[model samples]
Target chain A: MQLTERHRKYWRANLRLTGTLLAIWFAVTFGVVWFARELADIKFLNFPLPFWVGAQGALIVYVLLVRHYARRMNELDEEYGVAEDGR
Target chain B: MSRAFANRIKKYYSFYTGAFVMFVLALAVAEYMGMPDQWIGWTFMAATVALYAGIGIVSRTADVTEYYVAGRRVPAIFNGMATGADWMSAASFIGMAGTLYAKGYDGLAFVMGWTGGYVLVALLLAPYLRKFGQFTIPDFMGARYGGHTARTIAVAGTILASFTYVTAQIYGVGIITSRFLGITFEIGVFVGLAGLLVCSFLGGMRAVTWTQVAQYIILIIAYLMPVVFMSYQVTSMPVPQLVYGTVLEKVTEREEEIMADPAQATARDAYRARAEEIGRAIAALEASGSNGESLAQLRRDKETAEAKARPIHHHAEPFPGETEAERDTARLNFIALTFCLMVGTASLPHVLIRFYTTPSVREARESVFWSLFFIFLLYFTAPAYAVFAKYEVYTNLIGSSIVELPGWVASWAKLGLVKVEDINGDGILQLAELTLNPDVIVLATPEIAGLPYVVAGLVAAGGLAAALSTADGLLLTIANALSHDVYYQMIDRQASTTRRLAVSKGLLLLVALIAAYVASLKPDTILSMVAWAFSIAAACFFPALVLGIFWQRATREGAIAGMLVGLGVTLFYLVGVKFYGMTKWLGITDVSAGIFGIPAGFVTIWLVSLFTPAPDRATLELVERVRYPSLRG
Candidate 1:
């Protein structure tokens, strides 16, 4: 099961995207919750910033992250000529 | 699926949606035309259950693939909706707003943790596993690890976790049924069990998937109606998610007013004195060394106080801690619980199996996104629902004369879900004097908003759908463990498809009946076991499943040891906290016991795999095939 340069390149790109999205994930989930008291002083759209983050912002970000990954991977599969449909 | 196939599905379901809408409208019209409230409730419950059962009958099958994985052709959006219904149990549908109402900012832990798990699934699991193409998680265990032992262990693990999980859902069924249908709880348990059976027992995943899609529609609509209506009434805004601060301002003022009012202070003192008097009586009985009926009665009184004790909470606070040390522990507990839920969500067997029904690796990843999106609809509005409910109580219910209180209050109080006490000898209701259980907040929402009886019926129907959908999945997961993994895979490898399906159906009926009986006993222990299911799944499969897919060097021995170690640590921590008089580790509750097990599992897998010989080439190739979405045959 030797890997070609094309395979290596696609895997690397996928990993990079996942790492970047997960970084945003960490910041949103733990960082926002951890500093919620301090962030409460700030307001966004007339809602307390931390409250908004916990209730809606973080969830929206999660949805986008997954969607972006799925779309990117599909394109990557096509570009690498490795898609299930043999693009 | 091909475009034409997708178009046909859309055409058929469009008609279904229209018919569902028509049924509800007709019921509403019937209510307007002097239909008895009891009859409206009966009609709503019966009509929805009958429709689901009809879908089940139409989808009935002896084909193994269709029964187990819905022919692996479910569309992305429908699978997503079904997954949403499957993921949302009684807890999410009926209890979330109530939790949000009670816990305020801290309660978002559940919303974030549950939804965030789908991200983990998309990145780390769904695409790879869907590419692997298995009937169940245990099938993956057997194939990847190349043995029956790992598969057997997984079957046992699946049955253990999913059985308790199903029992809890049945308990929810009983609760909602008794509340709305005016039946006893025991009868409700069996009645709801029949509805659950028709969906999964007949058509298997094919039926359950479609049934769940229909259920997701009812539940999301039912959940949103009261929230949207109340938001319009309070702030003249129909979209509840965006109108947060508008209602919060009034709620804040009321909180301050309640805090400063002398009558509230008097109410608090009265509560303390009453609790103290009961405590003193119990102490006297114990000091007398009497094991008489009087002593037992006093003990029950004390337990009642302990059960109803609502700790003081500030609606705006993030995490409550009076001191720096307590704050640190609170922070630790919150993060720990969130992490545990995220891992558990990825590893849950009932949820993981949903991915196998998708047509391809790409759809699996996309469906995870849809799952999160559909779930996000409700999670986003739950906080606003809580805030608006609080505003209503603060502005309208509180400070009103007790005798003149709204009929909704008396109605809920009759069920003992809402307790009102005139603690200060004043007839006026104070915020402190009213204790509303979490179930009351959601179930009573329609009544609180002065909505028609049909809307209340609709809410109850939504709750039934949520519970039934989850229960249907759990029942199948458990039955499959015995029938598919054990009987078909291990015991009767040469059995016909018909025989195998029959065994599965029989096992399913048996398991559902057992769960119903356990739920009927009204044991509080099942509720606690429900919390343990997440931890159990998190510990048993998270590390093994992840490494089995990603790391080719992961050996059979390594996986088994990791799962066992993880399971051992989780049970140890849970038992230690529950019965061994052990303090919580860094204030982490037993619900999140996976906090300890997950790390222990990862570490154990690393150490064990390093010491053991690497797996053979075929097994390693299986891992590679699973990891890459576009691998050539």
Candidate 2:
């Protein structure tokens, strides 16, 4: 149960990656969605900015966040020698 | 390719081939026999039942692992599709656009909240839960907390959340069947229940998974077809997804024009006048101590008058916030709703169980991405559909003569989904006179666009698929939670796999019957019930599940206390505000009821854990292992 340096390093790296992604998540989900009204004066692709963010923009950002997290985590797993082999 | 892969491909090929052949035959019969619209609806319903029944029979399995977790062998892509179908219940497929149509900007809470939760799922829950290798959410709860009490609390939460959700799905099925097949709502509930049970009972998760993939196909096609046609008709653009932007502009422009028009102003004034007259009459009668059928009739008359006036108010000022205070409330409600949905989505037992079916932690994460991608195909289109459908109502139906209104209007009106009355005796359908239920928007889209009757039937089938797919997943979750977590693990730990499977299947039937009966009673609106389900899940499970994964210091006492407190606050707030109408007590509306429970739950968990002794070293190591999959025990 003792934590090795390797375990600490791996945990740190994972937390760091998750933190960065979650920050972006907070920005996209809460920041954009909540402050959308302020950006309403600006229009995007013929729709109001707030409307565009609520309808399409926020969702796209969420998908990218997930994809980025998955890709980075998978790489982290490999670097840490924790990746599961295809059974 | 492996034999199972080849067999899956062949199985799908034959299934699609058979479905296509049956569809064409049904079309031909409709054309040749000149079948009525009701018969067309019946044919669609029958085809769906047969297809799901066929898949269930084909995938029938006796292996307990397969029944419980689809043998943990589902590939990411197919699992993603099945999960997509499982995630998008009747609310997403049918009621979502209708909500958008009715609420406008406020509806984005659902749009953003439901989809954003997938990010939380991929980041926080799915991979670790898959690594834990549990059959159900309660399994994780019981294992991590190491007790019957934690497991039982989880079972209670799961049943409460999933049962409410399954009832809503069944209600959606009843609505769809009654509208399409011209059957009574009660019969529709039983029919939909029968279809749901047939697929789920035969093979459990294994059958449900394949059936859901097939449903994803039907629902997406059914959902997109009408909107695509409507978009092309309005904007002369084939891609409704892109063209809806232009439609929004046009609709806004039309709204302004209607607001400015003197005729519309006069009609609005007349509606207002009538509403005020009824209001005063009711008040005067009450003041005079009138307390008989006449007073009740006056109240009913006032309700009808207000209903007639509401659309005019909408046409005049669509969004909720006409004033600054209203805007703040709307904004607060929107954020609160989205937060609740995100937490609820991540906590849902039925959804998390899908992750357990994936082969690896990586695949579980990958499947979350795919689930979101598939769900986005529908979510992104929902707003566009709302825009076009609203435009259709605003531009054409608002001013048309009642006699000249389309056949679909009469049919929908007969079902009380759309009510058009010339309150002022002006043969022309004024905006004030049209009271359209949000549920009718998607159903009427095909007819409003002048599409073939067959396409309407297809939409009905798609709705049925959406309802049935979610119901199957929900039933399985409840059944598994009861059988595995409650019966086998807690009551009789030495039970055989065969005995467990039988108990699970039996529980599935029992739960489905109870859900159908409740759905037949029809407690609330589909969207409202769906929203309440999210609040319940958010309060009951979100804190415990999230903290269990991340905070190593979290003790079993803290978790149990957190869940109980969270669920208790939510139920109290919900019942107090919703059933008892005690909104003033907590200043919490039904939509924002989770505001009270979620934060209280998190604080309780944190505070309780800080005071309690740290969990045993073995439990800490288990948490570490779950966090770092590379770590060896």
Candidate 3:
């Protein structure tokens, strides 16, 4: 039950990664969607920026956020000697 | 992938592909044999139900663990597909494009909120819950909080949220069944309910999961085929997903042109003249001091006149806000709606439970990624469907002579789904003369484009698949909560596995019957009811589940208190503002009731935890174990 230095390091790394990814999540979802109207004045690939972002860009970003979190968490698990054996 | 995993994928792939090919051949034969449209629709409905029922029967198992969690052996990719089907209910499949067609940019709240919530699921809940490895969400609550009281509260929240959600799905089933089978809506509810019970009650979660995978295939194909065909028709481009940007630009240009046309201006003037006449008539009735019945009659007439006039005045535009205050409210509404939906998606019990069926924590994470990937296939195509459907309507239908309008319009008008009155007496379809229920857009698309009648039947089957897949998952969640969480765990405490499984099956039937009766009543539109369900889930369960995993200091008392307050406040606000027309509290509407309840729950849990004693050492250790899998006992 005792918390060791190794556990503390793994936990801190996980939290930091989670925090950073969440910030990006907030920026893409809320930040981009809220300012979508202002971004409409700009065009991307011949489509309105906000429209393209709202319709497609935000979702792709969300998928990447999840994929990154999974890969990083797996790395953290292995580094801390806690990874599943893939039974 | 491992050899075993690859083989499982190949097995299911070959099975589904064979089934799909056979169904297509049957449909082709039916068409070539010159079956009537009614017969074709009935055949599609019957064949699909038979296919699902067959899968359910084959996968049926009486083992308690398998019944509850599919034996926790589902491969990641397959689980992801099943979850995607469960997640994309009737609201996503049937109503999403219609909403986009009607609301334009504002409706992207649904798109963003739903898909974005997967991130929250992957990071905040699914992996840890999978590591906990419980049969149900309430099981985690009970063990983590160390008492039956927490479990009971958690069960109550799950039932309330799941029941509301399942009712909407059942309502969607009724709509699809009645429209396709040419039966009454009540009859459709019973038929759909029968299909739902057979698929869910026979094998429980095991049957439902496999059936859901098959349903996902049907729904995705049914949804994409018409839209892709339409896209090609419009832009000579085969990829609707890529070509829609040009369609959107064209739609905007056409809207601007229509707004400036003199013909539109004349139609608007005529609509205004009718509205003025109605207003004068209403004033005359009021001035004469007519009786209440006559006054009511006059008001109804006025409403009819206005309904006929409004669309001409505001056709196919983003939510119109003439003032700064109104614009601000619209923006706030958009943000509030999206935030609530995101949290709600993460907190839904049925969705959360799907993660528990994954084989490991890593697979749980992978499953979330695949679920979003499968869902994106549909979400990416929805806006294109809306744009192309709108383009078709704006270019071809509006301004056509009423007699020359497409045959589908007359047929749909007969069913009251589309209305055309030729209000200007020009014998032509003015924009004002035409109105449509948004639900019919997806259903009517194939016919509008003059595709084979069988495509319409295929679309109906797809809609049914969407509704039934979600219903199966939700019904199982409610049944498990009742039989496992309450009956065996709380009441008996010594029930055998067989007995528990039997009880769960019985409870599933009872719940399905009740949901069907509610669906028969036709309570609300599919999307609105779904929104309400999401708000309830977000408000009640989101805080407890998220904080329980992340915040080691969170106590049982705090969790229990937060759940009760959150559920109570959300239900109170929704019932008050929505049903009774009470003024919104803090300018927050019922759809975003979570705006008030979520924070209250989070703050209450944090504040109360700060003042209370810390949880026992064992409980803290369990939290650590859930957080770090290597430490699991």
Top-scoring candidate (DockQ): 1
Chain A only: TM-score of every candidate? 0.92, 0.86, 0.91
TM-score of chain A of 2: 0.86
- Give the per-residue lDDT digits (tens) of candidate 2, residues B147-248: 888889999988888888899899989988888888899999998998998889989999999899888888888899889888788888879877677778
**Cα lDDT of all candidates, in order?**
0.87, 0.83, 0.84
The residue pairs that clash in candidate 1, if any, are none
Worst 10 residues of 3 chain B by lDDT: B311-320
Docking class of 3: medium
- Give a tens-digit lDDT track for model 3, residues B1-633: 455874776597678868886786688687888989898899889988998999899988988878999988888888888999999999889889988888887888888888989999988998999999989989988988779988999898888789978998898898889888889999989999988988888888889998899899999989988888888888898788888878777777777767776665566567778878878987887888877887777677777666655533122233346676766677788788889999999999999999999888888888898998898889878877888888888888877788998898888888898988766677877666677878778988998777888888989999999999999999999999999999999999998888888898889999999988887887755436567888888888889888888899999899888988888888888888977989976566788988878998998888888888999998888888888867522
Report the C-alpha lDDT of model 2 over A1-87, residue by residue, as the tens digit: 777777778788988977888888778777766676677667678887777778888899889888888888888888877677654
Off by over 4 Å in 2: B1-36, B284-319, B525-528, B583-588
DockQ of each: 0.65, 0.58, 0.59
Error in Å for residue B24 of model 2 = 5.3
lDDT of 1 by residue, B1-633 (tens): 355776788788889888878888898899899999999888889999999999999999889999999999898888999999999999998888898898888888888998898888888889888999979999999998877988998987898778888999999999998888899999999999999988988899999999999999999999999989988887788888988776876787788787777777777777667677898987887888878888767767666554334335556677877788887787778788888888889889999999999988888988999998999998888888888888888888889999998899899899998989887888998776888888877888898888999999999999999999999998998898899999999998999999999999999999999999999998877887887888889899989998897678888888888888999999999989987879887788888899999989888988998999989988977877776776653
Candidate with top TM-score is 1
Question: Each prediction's Cα RMSD?
Answer: 2.0, 2.8, 2.6
Model 2 has a DockQ score of 0.58
Q: In angstroms, give how far residue B315 of model 1 lies from its true place.
A: 1.3
The lDDT, on a scale of 0 to 1, for candidate 2 is 0.83
